[model samples]
Target: MSGAIIMLNAYFSPSDLAHVKICPSAKWSPKGEIVAGINGKGSEPDQFDTPYDIFIDEYNNMFVADSLNHRIQKWPPGSTKGATVGSMARPLVGIPYPTKIFVDSEESVYALDYGHDENNNSIVKWRRGLGNNGTLVINEGIAIGGLCGDMDGNLYISDYDKNEILKWSPGSTKGILMAGGKGRGKALIQFDGPRELYVDGTHNIYVNDEQNYRVQKWRPDHINAATVAGGIKCLNDFAVDMDGNVYTVDSCNSIVQKWSPHSSTPITVVNGDPSGIYAISFDTYGNMFLCEGNENRIRKYSIIYNDC
Candidate 1:
């Protein structure tokens, strides 16, 4: 259940459909040739059922949110099989359907459940080495689309129903409105279907305004958001590297673009691949991994650059 290592020869090139230009001094390439996945792509223990999100921990263990499977599978580095870390079959009160999974600095796992019980969308936390079941952290009645954590262990969730983002401090029961509590709009303070988000060390939030077709950057404690990148169709997810560069996946265009801070234009890193990518993430080594929903596989890409 491993993926193939694809070596892309041209870093950037001008084509009839998508124009890409590679810098003479710098280029992009793949790293070591270790690509792994489940046995085929299904609901079996060794398979994945429409994985929507993935998180790599400090020890290089990967946690995948098997959305349709209603479980989270933990795959150790270099291991072929994965163990179920969290699942709806666990002793939980309601039907816990996990949509997104986030691992904090302490290796604690948090999942955003769809709340099939009474429409009580909740965020559950599971400490490292603990059992499958998680403790309820936030049980507010809101439709959550994405979940991410800051460096200080604070959690941020995107409310698709409210068209806003909610923030929850560690050990807090209730969540406060961080942004977009207003109705959906194209304004600076509103969000129309805010799906995926990433919070940096400085507490600044980068959210994918899916329906608005733009990615927004909201500074700490700021109500107004500035558009970092836009004009793409159907932005699915985004990830921020250690250097503050933002990478976003466009479903409609079938490409992933890299946008430097405050830059209007984006450099095309991942070319147009028609697999229907649903999520994007970065590991500790700056390697990028994307979850292709249709292909039922996760593709890894390494970044190569220079000072110029």
Candidate 2:
């Protein structure tokens, strides 16, 4: 109960993990299972190309930003063949190479354009059955890298170029700075290559300070941020559990690391592998889903707890 547990928005402590575990996972867990996509990469309905991020709703419905395919695919509770929900053909120019996604309670999906096109650096919103297109909301962000939303309907975006995170309220055109605008540095107030943000229940902001090789937590106090985890590299994605433990994606080495509160280094939750894991999410049932960018698929792992 010292550090945060793994996966998604669902929080778990070390004691509650006996119920569900990622089978055949890493050293802590068992192994992994491929829940979505296929053996090889393709553009078919059941395939993904450079799948970047994932958002799993309470109902276990998954929304994926199939980056290279130039579309957002929705996979229902038990379906492998996903339906194209967000695309490039339509009312909006469309999300070209969506890198990240966030799904609000209203089922409205926000897709962040990876800035593949200078004119298309935008975030598109798509609701259920919105026909193949989405409405462009925030456009031309300065190298938007990561995005997430809170219960208050506020959107948090990490601007890589500006080295800061901005908060956007519902229907608001302008964003207020939340953290790290003082240029990139090792200072707690500064952020270098900030990416993969998360908003907890209390509206706390968790940021992966990539260049600095650490994760910082910004509370509502409006004071200096705290370094939750340090001495890691290429934190492509991470999640904070109910216990405040931080789990991060050490992408450069192809592993997932679990960092407890106030820890200097992290324990490797996942072991060595060759695939490129860009993003990851965990479900309430202890299923771990990760976007294997190099493999072009989303794989799930069930943690096995033996006599724990």
Candidate 3:
């Protein structure tokens, strides 16, 4: 097959929201359309309130951590409205404040609550289909900045306050310090405000060192982490695709960069004017989705590569 690149532009809303546009490229592959949420801001099911994070499952369903509303919304592909899967105002039981969400292979939903009260700020797990209430999994004293799971169901959390990453086994009471447990610093073994993390199939952990404006990768038995990419204006969130390619959003520069494994430099995937990207994720089909928090919209980008 011959390789060719195509660029297409599509407008979402017919009104002022027309500013919300999808620019698709063959190499970068953003499907020229708005997959979920509306362009303008609102609290309705079709809208979002400063959506902090997003996770797309194997079935193309999008689960959003609607931070301001304090709820988790499940948006099926092509649907205008989403179902409130988890919320702080659930009738009998609910999480007080939910900041991030992760969906495992079994479709289990894991949410990180930032803690509104003394007993808050923990990790909650809700089994597949049991969306009403969640069970507390990890309840540490300090708040958790990021949460991710590996192939073996092991959980990894980034404690911003402690400046470390904790690894918790399936049923363990407490987590073992995997990296950066020692105070905040710019050393190889230390981290300053580690935010989001991603674990690949081989259990390699990749963390966004938010304060340091860099991304670090740690192996299973490594004592220190190697910097993969850095020098971005502001690093907010990141995602790793099946091929081990790393994608991260730089909020300050308003662009997204793609880095190959062990590569120090990155290929600018999403570049140009300020978009205010708060989060980034990939679907099963390798499509990239960005959460434009300031614009209050979710944009989709489909990647297509043809081997000639």
Candidate 4:
């Protein structure tokens, strides 16, 4: 049996994704451009209260998990206004607080409705038609933190309540334990509070151990997860480039840093923001998008330096 590391993600593989300008050695512009949200808090089409996650689709459209607003907003390229594309406030779905989101190739939006009526935590999918009464992918007593899908359509979910990761095959009613079933701890086999995970092509899981302030990579069928990046200050979201370089936002200090596989410490990427950057993502052009939670703005930082 040949055992080799397999690198993969929902979007692209590690080996083939570097040409778009996302590299560990690259530097982003010090200033950020307002791509979404009007620098104010409101329920208007151009405003946001607390945006938690950012998902960039294949078409370069940005999908935001508007946590406080309890909806998902889809903003097309060069658009200042966004459409309310997903929600859990329908008469049938009850009131919910959505926290994380992902957009598939078909542009369907999937959000983790963290709490609905205090007990109905679920993953809801809003199809292309954009309806409030979205289809429930998983529900009933689950405390969801984050979720993502693989090429095979399998869903990987992080359960904060159980401190574990579960994999739900397409059409399956239940999720099988994939990692971190030993309760919450700092050990490699445990998750203090897991959030925002991505499944690579070779089945390795890159998970954000939020409370632990680090990123851990769980290889396929393995019990221990190796820390990819550590010593972060309140890391809320992260993105890995095709070269396996990890980019993270220090949510508390408003700093951004990059972790290369060859370095023990991280290189500061950005600093001096509004001090509440909650999420991060990279566009096809290698520009950076950050969700400023306190400022209610999606800030875009273009690539200012590239070694390649």
Candidate 5:
């Protein structure tokens, strides 16, 4: 099972590629077409003048998490280029480094904002229509910052340093530790520095067990843990296809491995580029989007099926 999704720097021209820098993460809208990502220009630690994660909304509105700039930016539909959108631009809401972001079906935006030097990360929520009145859903309390909302509207977060997944109901204020502990694999059910999180239609939560080198699935109704995919060397992120096939970024191996439900063997689809894949998502059209952290760009791939 092999596939490829070639991606171009949508923000630049082929002739200017030599002079442009790229970002590290990418995601597709629920409807696909528009691809969003966090971009940082230049080399080294301080060149990130406009370090932001942006996505085009359902209405083609671009929402940007202007991280270091401490703001949520917008680019309304039809704006070919610029940082502002829909009349309101320039730091709509104030904050710190807004790194990871997720938008729920209700149009509410959830952001994982990096905290102050002594504070933990924060999970902030921007309620649609409420505008600037949006509140901080979760405080500066999590270890790392990845967010996902389930079908039922429940939020699942990855607490990196704690090596666990946290869950919160639709309107709840506190988060409950879903899996893992403070230490690496503290118990048989725990993991080692879990990163991104995904919840399926059946409400099964999948955690990218980063340092542990595997993916763990936990049912909303079950407390026991199950290794849906394993034996991966240096795993970082993954996505579950509509048919339940698991596609993962086997980083150290420089390939995206797909595993059928409960299968022990994996099918490698890309190879020879050991970049840290930080994110993955499948579009409604069945095409897949991947975030090659070190590749500094997003790639799209279509899965062609052959009758055996």
Candidate 6:
């Protein structure tokens, strides 16, 4: 059962927007048909005020994290769709700066509030229709901006300022250090600042390891330290496919590279010059969804199987 890799067509609107910019983060729906992410428009002279973070939900609902506008918008899955859901609070629902969002099986929304004030930064979880209900509070000087969850219902947060990952269970305040804290020596490590995280079926924790320019894997049971995947460059967010092959968004390289535990070199599976990929993900069926930041769109790549 060998697997083949190939780059597919890019997805975006040419008539509506005309220009592609930067897409920060992207997520695939549980059903595998939709994708959502942040679309940053104009980096230089243009100065387009279109910084919309989109959410492609299971039902194909697109939610945009409009940062500068101070709101989250929604775009339903259809031909006649556009952004709908938004943070209408006087000052923007206290979700000042949202980095990422995760929706559970129950449709509950979990957003990472980088926070207006560094001291007030927190991870907010809101019920489907009930708006923002406080779940876990990090008021004690702990700022949570990135997040991921495990099979057993435990939540993992990337503490950028602290340069570590904190483990939080249901109704728990005290978090255990999963990786990169003060005691850990800051090398490729000891992340200069950690970003997003992904937990696999085997309980392996994959930290973005952002500033380190690679991804780090660690086991909950074995917390001695973290291991690098293959010394990637400018790794944004990485995801494990159905077969456990690791795929990372190499922004600097403008391509999505695939890695394996046995391989030293990563193979480019997708390419777009200066694409500026912010996130990468895989659906249950093995399809790859890339958040092309420079293109301001989410493109899908089918993993072609072949004898390797």
| Best by the TM-score measure | 4
Model 3: residues with Cα > 4 Å off, grouped in runs? 1-26, 29-32, 90-93, 115-120, 304-308
Across 1-308, the per-residue lDDT of candidate 6 in tens digits comes to 11111101211111100111111122222222223333335322112133323334445444444444444555444332233233435442446666566554444555666656664466555455655433433444565657766545666778777788887665566777877786334463477667777776667777776666667777767645445464665776676643445667777777776676556576666665336666654433345555554554554554444322
Deviation (Å) of 26 in candidate 2: 11
* 10 residues in a row with least lDDT, candidate 2: 1-10
Instruction: Order the candidates by TM-score, highest first.
Output: 4, 2, 3, 1, 6, 5
Tens-digit lDDT string for candidate 4 (27-85): 88998988888748998989997888888866688888888888888899999888988
| Descending-lDDT candidate ranking | 4, 2, 3, 1, 5, 6
Q: If both were scored by lDDT, which would come out higher, candidate 1 or candidate 5?
A: 1
- Cα RMSD of all models vs. native, in order, equals 9.8, 6.9, 10.7, 5.6, 11.4, 11.3
After superposition, the stretches of candidate 1 with alpha carbons farther than 4 Å from their true spots are 1-27, 30-34, 90-96, 115-119, 304-308
Task: Please give the lDDT score at residue 221 for candidate 2.
Answer: 68
Candidate 5 off by > 4 Å:
1-95, 115-119, 128-134, 181-183, 273-276, 304-308
lDDT for each residue of candidate 2 in 1-308, tens digit (9 for 90 to 100)? 01111112322111112223333223444356677787567789999888898877766788888988999888987796888988888544588788888776556677887645543356777766658777777775367778887766677889877899988776566788999899979898999988888887777889989899889999996768999988787778887666677778877888887776755667777777436888877766656677888888777775555232
lDDT of candidate model 2 versus the reference = 0.74
In lDDT terms, how accurate is model 4? 0.77
Candidate 1, after superposition: displacement of residue 64 in Å?
0.5
Number of clashes in every candidate structure? 0, 16, 7, 2, 4, 11
Q: What local lDDT does model 1 show for residue 301?
A: 70
How close to the true structure is residue 20 of candidate 6, measured as C-alpha lDDT?
15
Best by lDDT: 4
lDDT of 5 at 6: 13
The C-alpha lDDT values of all candidates are 0.69, 0.74, 0.72, 0.77, 0.55, 0.53
Name the regions of candidate 2 deviating beyond 4 angstroms: 1-29, 116-120, 306-308
User: How many backbone collisions does model 3 have?
Assistant: 7
Residue range 1-308, candidate 1, lDDT tens digits: 11111112211110110112223233345332224453557877667777777777656677788778778888776667678877775544222567778876555667878756534577776665766767666666767788877655566788887898887665555678888888989999999988888776567788888889888989986769989888878787777665566678887777888877656788877777536788776555555677776666666776576334
